[model samples]
Target: MFRTAVGAVGLLAALAAVPPASAESNSDYSVLIISRERLEVATSCEIGVYLNDQLSGRVFQEQSTSFNLPPGPVDVRLRLLPGQMPGCAAGIEDQRSTRLNLQAGQINKYRIAMGHNGLELRRASLGY
Candidate 1:
């Protein structure tokens, strides 16, 4: 019984030497998706998606793309680019810098749709 007590105390001491988990170690991330809600009128151009004024990706009609980003505020922009489709023309540009307020291990969705002024980036509800 005395040997058992000493071994248990030694094990406890070793465990206490280890550092505790930190909040930063969690490294939470957010998932963002840009979905083309519908085809543009008189145009078949692929829209350019920009993150923080840098070109990220392009989305075509009925297509979608996703990004895994750190949880925080992000700047997103969208613009219609010239495409191979005949009669397609560049439309107005859209941009927005919004805070997602995302939580750890959560996903955020956005819909890319055309508004009266130009392209739009709106938050969309998750299906699942």
Candidate 2:
């Protein structure tokens, strides 16, 4: 009985030393914040946000979205999504993508704006 108790205690101690499998850490990821709060674009269309060519999220006027991406280069493409608005049809705007190098534990912000060419992302400050 004493030997079984000792073994159980040893097993309990070993289990306590190991980290829980569900205890995930976000330190390896970076945050990307895209905001459309500025009136520079002046459009009622919802903007489609693509990560590596995959449609991830959407943002409208005075709105924003954030993504937790892994550390590396991410291809961010912005396009006006077809919606209820008459002028929000697809293929009405440029489809250029911007490549951003994201670092771990860093937060990068950008504001959608209408550049000379078309819709583009401009580096923005931390707050709106």
Candidate 3:
């Protein structure tokens, strides 16, 4: 009985020395939030959000989406996606990309706005 108890205690100590497999450290990533809560575009078409030239998410009016990315520079692009609505076809607008620097453990928020040239992203406060 004493040997079994000692073995059990040794196993417990070994288990306690290792960390859980599901443990994730949040400091390794940064949060990116894109919102389209305003009527700046004044269109009903869904906007395609691209990261590193890849489509990551889509946002419509009064909607928002977020992503957790590694700490580095990320290319962000916004364009109107061809949807079920009229005049919402591809190749109708200039496709431009913007570069954003992301830091570790930081939250960045941006809102869609109509720029002088085309659709763009503008920095927004976190209160919303």
Candidate 4:
């Protein structure tokens, strides 16, 4: 009888120690950005992607890093950082920025010519 009581107490403790299930509505969405002509590695260009006129994140092709952004409308702007300044800005007549229109759980990508090195902003087409 004592062993049974001990077992019952242990069982009760174990049950109490169990973690409760979480009740959270997970946001299901993801996106990935790639250059139009494929950005070269070890370059000085800095790619800045914005979402809904908001700053999402910047990507340096030299150091491969993932930009974590929630699924939604994103406005992307590609610019050459201070170091990659001349090539992206100098002589290049077209460095226009681009505005991206995306939805939840969708991947909106933007492509630009390496020559046009200004700020070409355009509306994102959710084609694929």
| lDDT ranking from best candidate downward | 3, 2, 1, 4
Which model scores highest in lDDT?
3
Number of the top TM-score candidate:
3
lDDT of 4 by residue, 1-128 (tens): 99999999999999999999985433455565554334533356665554454556665653323344666555555554444456644333343445455556555454443443544433335465
**RMSD, each candidate, Å?**
7.5, 3.8, 3.7, 7.1
> Which stretches of candidate 4 lie above 4 Å from their native place?
1-27, 36-66, 84-97, 114-128
Q: What lDDT does each candidate get?
A: 0.75, 0.92, 0.94, 0.52
For all candidates, what are the clash counts? 0, 0, 0, 15
Cα lDDT of candidate 2 equals: 0.92
lDDT string, candidate 3, 1-128, tens digits: 99999999999999999988885689899999999998989889999999999999999899999999999999999999999999899876776799999999999999999998788999999994
TM-score of each: 0.65, 0.80, 0.82, 0.42
Q: What is the per-residue lDDT of model 1 for residues 1-128, given as tens digits with 9 covering 90 to 100?
A: 99999999999999999999866544477788888755543346777888888889998878889998888778887887777876457644445544456665677788876667677777888878
How would you encode candidate 2's per-residue C-alpha lDDT over 12-110 as one tens digit per residue? 999999988784477789999999998988789999999999999999999999999999999999988999999887875667799999999999999
lDDT of 4 at 97: 48
Between prediction 1 and prediction 4, the one with superior lDDT is 1
lDDT of 4: 0.52
